[model samples]
Target: MSADVNTGTREFILPDLGEGLTEAELISWKVEIGDEVHVDQMVVEVESAKSVVELPCPYAGQVVSLHANAGDTVSAGQALLTVAEAGVEMGAGDEGDGGTPASVSQSGSSTENSSGANLIGYGTSEPKTRSAKKRSFGGKHAAAPAVPTVIPDAPSQPPAETPASPSNSSTTANDRVSPVSSPLVRKLAKDHGISAKSLPGTGPGGVVTRADVMAAIESGAGAAAHVPAGTSPAKASSPAASSDQSDRDTRTPITGLRKVVSERLTKSRQEIPEATIWLDVDATELLATKKALEARTGEKYSLLSLVARFVVAGLKKYPIINSSIDTAAGEIVTHGDINLGLAAQTPRGLMVPVVHGAGELSLRQLRDSVSGTVGKAASGKFDPSELTGGTFTLNNYGVFGVDGSAPIINLPEVAMLGLGRIKDRPWVVDGELTVRKVMYLSFVFDHRACDGQEPSEFLTFVADCIENPISLLPEL
Candidate 1:
């Protein structure tokens, strides 16, 4: 999609973000028109159906145009922006919003320092000699021509007038147009004297996330920022208004990530012949083991991590539980790597972040990896690649304080393991009645992949690990 502009310009088009992702919502522009951008420098941030990611540009030159505005949906191969290559003459229009410095002549090397990581597609690997040659359209690379912003598959609207300077605007939160989601995040920004609208959002569709607030707080981006002391993050309304709001049913259009989740879950339910089995396990030893390990090593350990370790062992002893039915190929695909998927709940929605080669990681390393991936759920920064390639999934419904659930299998994966909250309950221990910590384990599987026997064995093995933690030591 590269086009020649003048004798030295390249129209940068969006690249395929990830597997099956055809479109993404343009969140924001990192570089405004006339500003210089280098290869591997993040030029725009977009949220696809899979995840939110910052896109690095390949061209190192002055930005001449932004094809779409924030909140606009852009498809792959669509022109994102145009960049005027280095060593090119410029007119007054070549300058950015404020104005380009005389330093434009020296933009060759001064503007080419790239040390950022490239994402799924497009970036540092792109070349510098991709500029377009002259054409006969009665044009001389019209420097920064007044081109209409192109938005795909949406209603037409007049283009927004570009501001004179790129800086924070002095406006009230109510008056300022920004995507602030949670009231809690608003309060955080308000407490620090900063405006949530001013801080960059890292959440889905540019919605501000709690992690974004903490980052702002740590960076002192909130210091001396104004948020009215009396201003409530929640919108205030009269009693009559509140009553009217309650009367009308709210209908939210599911489009981005939510749309994807809906389609996949529906497919899982409609296509896969799934079955659920449950067992109540005594978790007294598992809890005690987690506590003992933490006390002895002076390092915090999560119960989920301990249970995940047990699940990995169970999968190894029973590999059939880790297989998927490839209906199209008429074969069962048994993945070699134990790419364990953790059902992560984020502000955006439910996401499964897979830990590649989870079986290879030690207990401590496993804990760290799980913790780090789940931690990113708050910030909504999970890369598209991290959300796929799973052979099995682990869902902790207990985190929501639920006892048990027959959750649907994450498709392409044959089975899913669910953990319930451990609570004090009466149980017979060694022929005597005693109070013990007990939790229900729900194992869901695709009947097409395995029958009752294999899944029963896997669940029983995991149950044994919970009942007697010592049994896992020999296997480890």
Candidate 2:
């Protein structure tokens, strides 16, 4: 490892390491410029949207320059550092157009084409400079770039002549940043077929206020802002765009956890023939059991744990329900032990953590495990093993105060069970209409592996267990 012999130059750029990561913060640089690095050596540690990931150097050479400093938010594909090949001379400072460009250019030069820097060799074009731009959750330095102005109460007007580029104007608005609008606003806009771009905002800095959109609908000018640019007066009078300028926003680049989840879900759906079964059970006793257990053990557990307990016990009775199909071996696996997964929603996406040997655990132990798993899932810190080896999955929609839904079957596992809210429903006990706490359960199964008769019977068995807790006491 001599100090001055690297000849080839290669650039290492930031990569989109996934889970909806738009940018990453450079945590540390492992290799310094002038330090020789081998391919696959740890080059840097960058914190992504979900986790801190170490990126490896792809080229073996001496680190010639660090393009990005620590603490900078780097966009995907932006150059992070450059490496010089062994024995290459550091080129002169003068910019020459004969060889391939240097990496410092604004658009950035790829390592494949960039010229090796040398004192006597052919000069290279200047590399692109790193963009000094940063994005903010709030609007970025809201000195509004001069662009066309649209008013909520009045007609759209041309922007006053100004010096800002059109590209900058398109993205500088604050409306593009707020991802969490109320559900009512979302539904209203969706029903009216109105897009954010078609609105003349009434909120701060011409941002679209929900009330502004509602008013536009009520006042009969709903079509005004939506008209196509430069249309005739009669056609322009209509608020709905004549050509329907909206297509599903499907052009987004697939990266991160979303990509992984999408791929797995697609594969599972395509490969597995799923069959769903529904059950409306009187959960009056199940709710009573939960209250009693919480009171006796002085431990806190949600309805999710209660449902998980039922699922684990049911899978024990119907072991086939907790199995994965072995296509290679041409066999169906019936799990003897249960690793029950409880579906938890996080900001990143839905994740399931398994309760190991769930049948072996007492009710209290099961509750505690589910509580910890869900807590870790919400904070996004569960280890990879905690999420794997699930014999069965449970999605509790009751937390959202919903009634019933057919949840998608988790991959590999034969079935997933959904738990709805416990509400009072009329049940005929001894031929009398009495109000009993009822829950709607939907079981989704892999039709290829699960027999149609077994899924319905399994659901009924789970309902029976839930209804009569004393029946489970004999097995326990």
Candidate 3:
């Protein structure tokens, strides 16, 4: 490794992309070797989580070599491509965001500066134009006026009143009452291209909620029709659109995170002989226990948290459920510590961030970890380690008002415990009929390594534990 050695190769390595992505699947190669590429031109599409992303080229030059092929698994810091920086008319800095486009405008909008002189480190690409024609309103329904960038304050004839800014303008797209907001709310708003000021928030300190963004989008669709009515026929002519459109639709390449998910899921289903066992439990006792625990601890507790704790406790009693079969060793490898994977549905896709060493955590600790990890995963900030190494999985489908579901086992994990909605149902108790809070539980296990008898015992243990949770902590 001599410093004086002429190393002319510029390596384009995979970036971590902030979500702590360690590995990404190559979806496709947009530019082949010998193709003249411009800085910030879209080079590839990688899926992370569920979002399909088009990665832009960071350098302007002829591609000298391709480091990886489509469908290949790539790790962060591994070279994806190589570009020769010689004889390129454009000049830019060398720093790359790993995923940020080479072209960046002053305002940070990626306007690709294909011209060599305009290239910085990477140049910004031109903004993709959304709509060129002005909005119009059709007959019988007058289009609402375009909300001006600034609204004029109403003139009031009052002797004394609250002091108002003389320069107070009307509400506009640029006007925001408060900018400090939760990242989820901001991300939701950005996804819809919505102006937050127009929304009335019901969250803490007037923070926007997920419902607010959804409502705003519903309102926009009606407003879109109204706005287009006022434009001229030539400008307002509707483009032919497919009628079979989903309410919200996006098409992304199967690359990066999505690609990995696709492959793993397929492999798991193909290779694993999985079997499911179902049990209906009377959750009334557990509900009461949860209430008592919450009151005693003076903390907010949900049934999901209680279930998580119960699952963790059950894993300890049924150690095989917490263990993975090491086929190479021809052994049933039982783990000493439990790492519980909590399946969370994110806007981009499904993510299971593990709660490390969950067997040792209390109910409160489990709740906090589950909540924080899911929140971060939804916001695309979960660390890569958070996503891997799960001995078992817990999937709560109750929030969707589901009674029970046979959830798929995450690959490498032997089982997935699905929890369903707790609802009042009539049941027999000591030869008497009674209405109780009932929840159906489904435990799906990989049957290749574990036997039917073992899984049945595991489910029975879990069901009994949930019904009699105090029995689990006698030694605690």
lDDT of 1 by residue, 1-476 (tens): 45443335566677877687777777889998768888778899988888888888877888876665665566777667777778765665433311212222322332322446544455543345323231111122322212211222234854346532325444333343345544445765665556776666554334456677778766655433443468564543443453354347343446568888999999999999999999999999999998999999999999999999999999888998888888889889887779899998887788999998998999999999988987898976787789888899999989889899999999988999999999999999889999999999999999988999999999999999999989988888
Residue-level lDDT of model 3, residues 338-402, one tens digit each, is 99998887765677888998988877788998778766765654655777788999998888899
The number of clashing residue pairs in each candidate reads: 3, 24, 27
Query: What is the per-residue lDDT of model 2 for residues 192-310, given as tens digits with 9 covering 90 to 100?
Result: 54564455644322334457556756555444545555876685534445224322222233444455568778888788888778988888887788789789978776777766777
State the lDDT at 265 in candidate 3: 86
The TM-score-based order of candidates, best leading, equals: 1, 2, 3
Query: What are the lDDT figures for the candidates, one per model?
Result: 0.72, 0.63, 0.61
Sorted on lDDT, best first, the list reads 1, 2, 3
- Candidate 1 lDDT at 223 equals 37
> lDDT value for candidate 3?
0.61
Clashing pairs in 1: 4-132, 6-141, 193-225
Model 3 Cα shift for residue 415 (angstroms): 1.2
Q: In model 2, which range of ten residues has the least summed lDDT? A: 93-102
Model 3 TM-score, all chains together: 0.54
